[model samples]
Target: MARPTTLLACCKLYISESRNDAALRAIEQAARGGGGGAVVVNRFTDDAYNRVGYTLVAPLTPSPAPPPLRHAVLGMVRAALEAIDFGAHAGTHPRLGAVDHICFHPLAHASLRHVADLAGAVAADIGDELQVPTFLYGAAHREGRTLASIRRQLGYFKPNSSGDQWRGAPETDALPVAPDAGPERPPRSKGVVVVGATSWVDNYNVPVHTGDVEAARRIARAVSERGGGLPSVQAMGLAHGGGVVEVACNLLDPARVGAEQVQGMVERLAAGEGLSVGKGYFTDFSQDKIVDLYFRSAANTEG
Candidate 1:
């Protein structure tokens, strides 16, 4: 069979493990090998959040053929599951598992359906082989579920331990909803994983110069779509270091709503509360930027 032209698919993994950079790097290396040359576009680690975000891209295998992206993601998850213990993990960010969340995005000419298939395959592997409960969201979900909805159902916002810390396993064997893969009950230590596929989205954060988390939460509500703010936007108020709060936003459609608009709205709303807004920052590179970097690295490797 002839090999199809290469297309791009990006995967983002939110891991509960980040304190050890070397361990994360080892997982990334294993992921690259499983990806069959997937590029690591960007990685961000937060000590406060006690989490890490890894963005990787690989060429999509032809239709009806097993794509390396699935293998790549599973390899990373396996490494994470082995190295990280969620029972002793704690972070400000809401999480349900060691490998908390996994999202796949189609780039270039790749279709959403293609990435969705990859998400499903990875979810199954993590659930069955690893025996961790896994939920599907976004395009990979038949009901078109959203991540926020699933998180809310899982009591992610609530801290089981103390002071924003999560310890032990999930409280109940009976979850609000059945997982798409794995056992209905969550296993010890690993918890559960949320896997999905969607279009390119930007995660932007704007710092608020105030210790009042309530004010930040209020601003987040005002800037979110549910709050009748911008279309295709989601916002959250998070506590940063040094008495500073942040308005973290997810731009679902950059064409519809960009960082500038989010920043403007946040600044305007924060000013009403006498809070000044700092410059906004994106967590990862844009899809176009990632693709360009991938090609450049590929060229350098070949040369």
Candidate 2:
């Protein structure tokens, strides 16, 4: 809906999964109306749907009183082998569910117990729905459910990773055997990893051209904070060891110089020099999502 059905008097923040054209405007208007903006996902399309994963946003809505209310988040990530099995079997985005290795970050003020509670709820539900056993990791753990340990117990294999080579072994030892689902039958689901909130950060690197001080300075100046370039962008020029120059920048807002846009800029800057641009982007938005404008204007009253 163009106009929100409910108008909150106090500032508010919430995540919307679907693609919304007015999200940016909505955030701005809401903030102006006393509601703060949220950590929203920005997406781009590649001629198809490439649903990678979701991002965790902290502190949805700021509390009116003193300190802001800590954002209570709940999410479930797929196991590596399990995700690969589904993806390859499903032929979705290249699998290997381990997007990045397990690195549990402790929430600022919460405990593993709290996260375990959420995971427990999800596991129980998955157990019922998929008729699959579940494992719980960290503090809010179950009697037999433990992460990484659970996979180790299950003898999870990455057939695709090793070219159909069975790398792990089934739990021949019953103690290490995976627990059952609701009924405790054959294990189906690769246990869940309950995550706790923490201070999250977004960082990236954009490789630059040869070590031409002037050219490097030009690109950096054209793409930095003090240059009125990208908003919240912090950039610097560094000299590479082999007499080549690089442009280092912190793109606080990818919305300004999106991945494609950044690549183009670098290419244009380095053109006629037979150089190439390599870039990286870390964001919480959808991959197929394309930012576009949707304007609704009232006809000229006088006309």
Candidate 3:
């Protein structure tokens, strides 16, 4: 049998875990068994954040309408919930659920509308089957809400427990804003999840050789568009454990303003602070590399 010539899309799912290799393995196994035509091209795990990010690619056309990306994401979320307890979860990165965030991006010939549809389906699956509150943003939202907007409404940027860390469950029985899907009250052990679909985004991190997270935050603010700096960039300074802090950035428009620009700005800002800066790194493969890996994985599967 020959596979159909189809458009491709990518889904980046962030689950809460860096330790417990057994649990992470089980989650990946469950995702693979979910029967999605999707292939996970990359898995990035951050120890300080205690998070695992999976990059999955799938055909947007052919093989059962809507594909099985929803099944795969749902399977991962379910496995994560089973393995992780939000009440005991603590990390430098801010998050809400065992499955922290899931975002879909159109790739190659895939359309944003189609990817948004897939995102909505996955959100519905988690909301209906698992009975979890799922919030929608980006193209999946009716009003085209941004993920940052939803995060702000949910107090995602603020640390709930320590001065610099988020520990235990989110401090709300009932959500401040009604969820786009699922119940009003979140289940204690498995907080709420945010889902969305958007254009390709670049994840870049510039490390500063300093433990002062606040200084890092100042540099991050100055580098972000929100603080009268780079256009089409969103940034946050986070402590990555050790004596290092990172200005984690999401380049919304990498084509116009790439990682090099962000890196230079960080370097200049850190120099002023008397902090040495390390070369930044991307958290995932490039678009061309991702496409190559997807096709290779598909061929291996078909063979």
Output the worst ten-in-a-row residue range by lDDT, candidate 1.
1-10
Ranking by lDDT: 3, 1, 2
**True-vs-predicted CA distance for residue 195, candidate 3, Å:** 0.4
Off by over 4 Å in 3: 1-5
TM-scores for all candidates: the values are 0.93, 0.32, 0.96
Model 2: residues >4 Å from true position, as ranges? Answer: 1-51, 56-108, 142-147, 160-176, 183-303
Cα lDDT tens digits, model 1, 93-206, are: 778988999999998779999899889999999999999999999999998899889989988867676543556567676789889999988866788999999999999999
Q: Who wins the TM-score comparison? A: 3
Sort by TM-score, top down from the best: 3, 1, 2
TM-score of decoy 2: 0.32
The 0-to-1 C-alpha lDDT of every candidate, in the order given, reads: 0.85, 0.35, 0.90
Report the C-alpha lDDT of model 2 over 1-303, residue by residue, as the tens digit.
122321111111112111332432443333233222222222222111122233222221234531111111111222222332222222111211222112222233334443334334544544565444444444435453333344454444223232322222122223244443344443322322222111122334355556564575677667665776665565545444344555555454556555555546656766745666556444333212211110011112113
Per-candidate alpha-carbon RMSD to the true structure: 2.5, 14.8, 1.6
Q: For candidate 3, what is the TM-score?
A: 0.96
